[model samples]
Target: YAGPLLEEEALNKAAEKGLSSPEFLELCVWLGSQIKSLCNMEESITSTDGGKDVESFQLEVSSFLREMACPYSSLISGDIKDRLREKEDCLKLLLFLSTELQALKILNSKKMKGSHLEKHNEVYQEVQTICDALGLSNSSASDILPLLTNVEQKIKDILSKVQNNHVGKSLLTKPLNSEQVERLGKINDALRSEYECRRRMLVKRLDVTVQSFGWSDRAKVKTDDIARIYQPKRYALSPKSTVTLAHLLAAREDLSKIIRTSSGSTRENTACAINKV
Candidate 1:
């Protein structure tokens, strides 16, 4: 990481001229910039320290680190005042701080990448679900908008057909005599009653089914749930069936080997048969 290089440069400079040198001040400024950038603070650290005395500058830096809740703030602040003038001690503290800040930057980058990946996966899954509902192949991400458009067009077509059917029925009824209309009305009422009776019977059956499954009456039962309830338990494979399955698998491998090694015409015929199946 850049931490080691920065520390080495700072140490070399400090060894030549001591901790109170311009090199030390530059290191402090760099550290301040890093902290501010990482925390997204608008205030300039150098501007805040301009014209301040050594004690005031130290206090400001310590307070700023504390306020930002920076990692290792307590340890760094505690050492900063006592070790600011000691070249070796000051360099060590700076090295630790720089390493920690660099680590924090890496972690933040990874978190951002992970969050973006999760969002992309969620969107992809949602698109795939939509494609499945519309019975479309989700072959590529570029197909998403076209799939949605196709679904919208299908809905529009269905609604248009329903409207036209309703209009046609109305037109047909307009030419009917009053007696015929009254007879049709009676028949409609009888059919409605019959349907209502059947609906009630189905509802009761559904309630019984729900109770059998230990589900609440208000709980929704989807097609898959009903299928699950009715699905037969699979028995363990018998020795004979196991042997048959192994033979089939072996045959599949042999067929694959044959397809790979066979002449062009034979390979094409096998491929066509596979596609047809």
Candidate 2:
């Protein structure tokens, strides 16, 4: 389907909505797993384009990347451009592990084997039924896991460069088609509605990345320190139970003055008060 060229306006307007969307966070967690899956593999494999589900999963991620990419702006440097392209390619490798692939993973699991659009077709049911009836005899096309590992770092780096960029048109670019913009726009809008849920999901998924990228060992994200990002800002004691050190010191000084002013009999009482403190 034709979409208007992704204009900067849409991305500038990119909503942080749905960060907690199960599907979106699930995808993010899936992405971290993809990185590790690629890293552990012996080689990279590719999937042949297949069912509608594959198309849907691919579109969800591709739309996100295209929205994040900046093909029209002069702002991104050559190294960054190449990195973005590599990131896009890495995401495609992740698709090889898609749920559609998992369903076809077993020989007995039905997958649509033939097109209903063909001449003299026997499976005359709707495409959905057609999809439901076919089964895999043995395999998925190829595993691209190893190839994905090679570019994971590159993609992460590109994200670092672009994550904070959402200010002016000249500084960013989308230049995407109508369908992509529209679909992603809705996602951004949905985010504003259920942000708490999304944030929780986002954190859970991002936490997985720490293990995948070995961030746990160093308390960092690539070159950047992430100890601050993952940590919640909380005091060990309650505000009502605590006083500033300065205030405590000043109060102690006043107590000392009271002890100095006390007569011999009252001095004993003041000493007890100081001892209690």
TM-score of each: 0.40, 0.15
Tens-digit lDDT string for candidate 2 (222-276): 4344444334422222223222322322342224344444578776656765467
Taking all chains together, the TM-score of candidate 1 against the true structure is 0.40
Candidate 2 scores a C-alpha RMSD against the true structure in Å of 31.3
How does residue 106 of candidate 1 score in lDDT?
94
Which ranges of candidate 1 are over 4 A from the true structure?
A: 1-10, 15-19, 40-49, 64-81, 136-277
Scanning candidate 2 in windows of ten residues, the lowest lDDT window is 11-20
C-alpha lDDT of candidate 2 relative to the true structure: 0.38
Q: What overall lDDT goes with each candidate model?
A: 0.57, 0.38
